[model samples]
Target: MTAPVSDHYSAPRRSALAATVVALVASVTGCAGTRAPGDEPAPTGQALVIGASLELTGQGSALGTQQEHALRILAAKLDVDGVPVGRTRRPVRLELRDNQSDPTLAARQAGELAGDEGIQALVGGTLPETALALEGVARKRKIPFLSLAPGAAVTGSPDDEGYVFKLTPDDADVARRLAEAVAAQKLRRVAVLAAQGSHGDAGAEALPTALKAAGVRLDRTGRLPATGSDFRAAVRRVATGRPDAVLVWATAPDSGAAAKELRRSGYRGAILFDSGAVAEQTLRGTEASAVEGAYAVHPMSLNGSTLTSIAGSALARRDFMYRYLQEYGEYHGFAPYAADALELVAAAARLADSLDRGRIRAFLETQVVEGMAGWYAFSPSRHGGMEADSLAVFVVSQGAWTRIS
Candidate 1:
């Protein structure tokens, strides 16, 4: 079932909080160092470094690049006053590496990062394969790893995922939302064109059950090529039945490519996408028109609305969006999972009063923070921190992703 939106604060309360947020944003942007009298003295300890192995120049670059931007912005912001760890406030640093979208390379990089004593926590992996690779390394090294990938298997078994946490919503939650959207539109039958990978595997596995519960029939399913070479044949196979709608469960580039191929193949039915399609590449150039009216199940952050209030999550999101716009000129509605990962790490460090890998991991399991993207409630049994209610429906309108629900 779709979750209801949370209640908004009253107008007076919102205005008061908004004023406080304005000051917070000013301090963040200005990097103000002045402290009030009687404030604790700043520490001169070494920076607390976080490591990241990302697909910066490969198939996952569409999402990885955005994450890289988020990490840089947040790292800089935190360094202004640093994060509190006990009585000391230490600066933040990021040691980033490019994994080239290869799972093998990602594993090697994760090993190298985890071996470094200065690197306390790790975050990366925009692709499921890369995330799984990193998870293996985190488990072996006993270091905390925050994964940005949507693959449910990243946290499949909590016993083995004690040191790992996922910042994205679970595949099952996304699938349920998509299925409900289809039912609401009265789309009786739907075909799924899933990409070939662990991400696709999870979606395909959970979708049938969700669609069934929503009272919608699953007409057919086809797999897009792993290399994303040619989607024409796959699109043809899935569009053959002329189902009421076609759901493309794939990441960017593939997501937009499949939409273009579907339109070219003369399939004019409604197009639906998984959260991975929220990347900038999905709506760029000709592909924008191809997916103009396509709907997607994504985090509520995709709305990217102007700041009207200053609730914790809303304020953080607004500040993040403002910083992102200053750095990149445009916000593509992608969730800042990397930013939240960094914040989560810092919060854990503060809670544990130490930077020890095991201590950070232990405290991480107890956090419940309102982050930039959404609310994350992490615990010993639940490593997939993003709340299900954070998922919402979005549609491509005028070459932009606009939240619909």
Candidate 2:
């Protein structure tokens, strides 16, 4: 009882319509295969797609949001400058996927994006664990991949994965910086508070060694699981011994929470927090009184001077600050690491020239681009451009981060 379908077009007309559709698809797909702007692309005329796996929702969401927007700025810059493809008359696309801070989901998202024809390279990162998963896949596929999170086990070690590149300094250097800082104060007894996971484990081990070398003792240590939201229990347990100083290795909120508990416990001694609290918001939650004298270490150039000469005058001392102001109205919420990662990835896209994975890896291995951070030079020999010794001790003053040294 179905009605007959309308067939106004004759057989010849239908054939012409089908042919035209095929031609249109061919033209679009062939866009990047050719260099000329006006010329139609080859059989596969698609733009290069760079895949990013980030924690866009969940505990790491705060950082993930900033990175998402920063990626947009990167896209705009490359499109205008015509760096690797777009500026060169061929366009490359930046594709981002949210991992929500779950390692399992991150791995699944990575697998889906790996083999797509539009995807030329991978930018999976935002955390050490996520980076580890992405690099494992990238290595097997021989695709170039970069990670922003610092993890000692990812690379450099004899049995580590060479296919991975890190933009952030690993815990090895941080341990030394912290040890030196504590040594300067001549503190003998040190209590530890660290979260569970790769960062915590690496730091837990590194700090003890560094402290031992510096002639300090790890009197007592308190460990918490990955999902432990409240830091009171661990902070209280570590407080029993009343060590000279409390060294805490954790993320932003955890740092704030621990800072609160340390103060509540009436501990008047110094507290060394993790570099993750470099963001102002992290410390803002703590009673301004709590973070007043709390100490941590960050790269010297972070708040020391503007890398204007390196990043160009267009991006003066306030390049990042200015960009954030333009978007957020109020300044300081945008994360600088995200911007740094975008710059690194764009540089790779530009220097590599071709979309081939092997060539991109080779070019990135020697990339020495000037970012907001400084001359962010990199080589296969070193994953992090910033030397570990470059740390400048700092403390919270008047609700803002100020250099201590």
| Top-scoring candidate (TM-score) | 1
lDDT values for all models: 0.82, 0.63
> Candidate 2 — which residues are off by over 4 angstroms?
1-48, 85-87, 90-92, 156-161, 304-317, 329-334, 374-377
RMSD values, in order shown:
4.6, 17.0
Query: Candidate 1: deviation at residue 391, Å?
Result: 0.7
TM-score of each: 0.90, 0.80
RMSD in Å for model 2: 17.0
- When summed lDDT is taken over every stretch of 10 residues in candidate 2, the lowest stretch is 25-34
Q: Tell me the deviation in Å of residue 331 in model 2.
A: 5.3
| TM accuracy, model 2 | 0.80
384: Cα error in model 2, Å: 3.7
Residues 285-366 of candidate 1 have per-residue lDDT tens digits of 7788899999998878777543344454576677789999998998866648898898778777776878888898888887
